[model samples]
Target: MRRCGPAAYPQPIRRCASCADGDRSLRTVTGIFLALGIGAATGLGLTAASVGRGTGAGVLHIGPWLATPKAGTTEADPYARAVTARLGTLPLALADGLALTAEADDGGQRLDGRCTYRVSGQMPPARFWTLGVVGEDYEPAAPAGQRRAFTSYEVLRQADLPIDVVIAATARPGNWLPSGGAAQIRLILRLYDTPIATTISTSTGLPAITRVACS
Candidate 1:
């Protein structure tokens, strides 16, 4: 019988006392079980930590940039990196509330094929909209197949008319712009230099980006 102590005691060389076996097989089995459990716990802890960090430090989520990941995009939430704010403009410009949102890359889905986003919002009469792509560093994430403008032109319905714009990328081009398989795309909806009558009373809405599968 090996004496195990409170201070750096040597492990017991005892066999299975209940099984009446003098072999060290039971000790080996117990050691293997303990090692597996520890490994599993460590792995789970690291995964949880990664998720927590990603949520706290990354992603843009707000008005113009409200977006979700496409189907089959990621096992985890890829939108964690898309954080939204009324940025790039001043308080006066955003007085009516800056509606902005950004969508991060679904790993590499956008690069493999075409992606479509249906953006709908109830904007002010003087409002305008543009959909642009940006890279991981927040710069323009331009795809190789098409050219894009910095901002969009006038996208209004009519005076006294509610606005609902559907933005998408077309292989043939009806009116939407091209996605170019960008690393990330941000939809910017802005009500230009005017006072909104109903800043607090108006509504804003848009659909998530839907990735079109490659043919």
Candidate 2:
């Protein structure tokens, strides 16, 4: 009876409101992804910058000269000059009494320690040793989540035995160290006052990094 103005011309036209909404949602999602990408890039950039400023990455030596420190010498009286002179060469072997292998991969001198320290040798009888994660600045790194620095001296033990120290994180109070699958760690094997001691000569060995992780 009555004719609609535009509808009467030909066919009916349906409104695409849902389609418009979908487009808007897509735009919102794209914006979110972009923001996330930017944040990730910024974080990576900071990490790289920090690494550059630290000793985490540098020319690596498999081992250093003079493996052990003097038995009676104290930290106050360091043998720095004597140690520096010895590190001129590379892959320095521990004296006959000791054995050590760089747990890190050769040519992988980022100072990112990802492997377990395998120290196999006759440890000194009366001496106590420790291994700790130190920063490239030669200080203790900040506490990381779920894991702390592991050392043989810190381990809660009942009886003394031949020391086979593996520096890793652990929650339980026992001999075993729980590695948190960290990206890196400095496997510092230390020997206290003993007849046959192995010392990481000052200004030698591997450098340290600040950002340490358990996993």
Q: Best candidate per lDDT, number?
A: 1
Error of 2 at 149 (Å): 5.0
Misplaced by over 4 Å in model 2 are 1-111, 114-122, 142-153, 156-160, 164-184, 197-215
Model 1 TM? 0.39
Per-residue CA lDDT of model 2 for 1-215, tens digit only, reads: 99679767887677699998999999999999999999999977765553332222222233421232321234312232233233331222223222222334233443343434333334344345554554443334335553334444565544644434444444333443434435543344444443343533343333222223323
lDDT of 1 by residue, 77-191 (tens): 4333222221322322333333333443323233322455543334444454444554444454444656443343543445554444333345443334555555345544433
Q: Name the TM-score of candidate 2.
A: 0.33
lDDT (Cα atoms) of all candidates against the true structure: 0.42, 0.41
Q: For model 2, how big is the CA root-mean-square deviation?
A: 15.7
Residue 34 in candidate 2 has what lDDT?
Answer: 100
The numbered model that scores best in TM-score is 1
lDDT of 2 at 144: 56
What residue runs in model 1 are displaced by over 4 Å at the alpha carbon?
1-99, 104-113, 143-146, 150-170, 194-203, 206-215
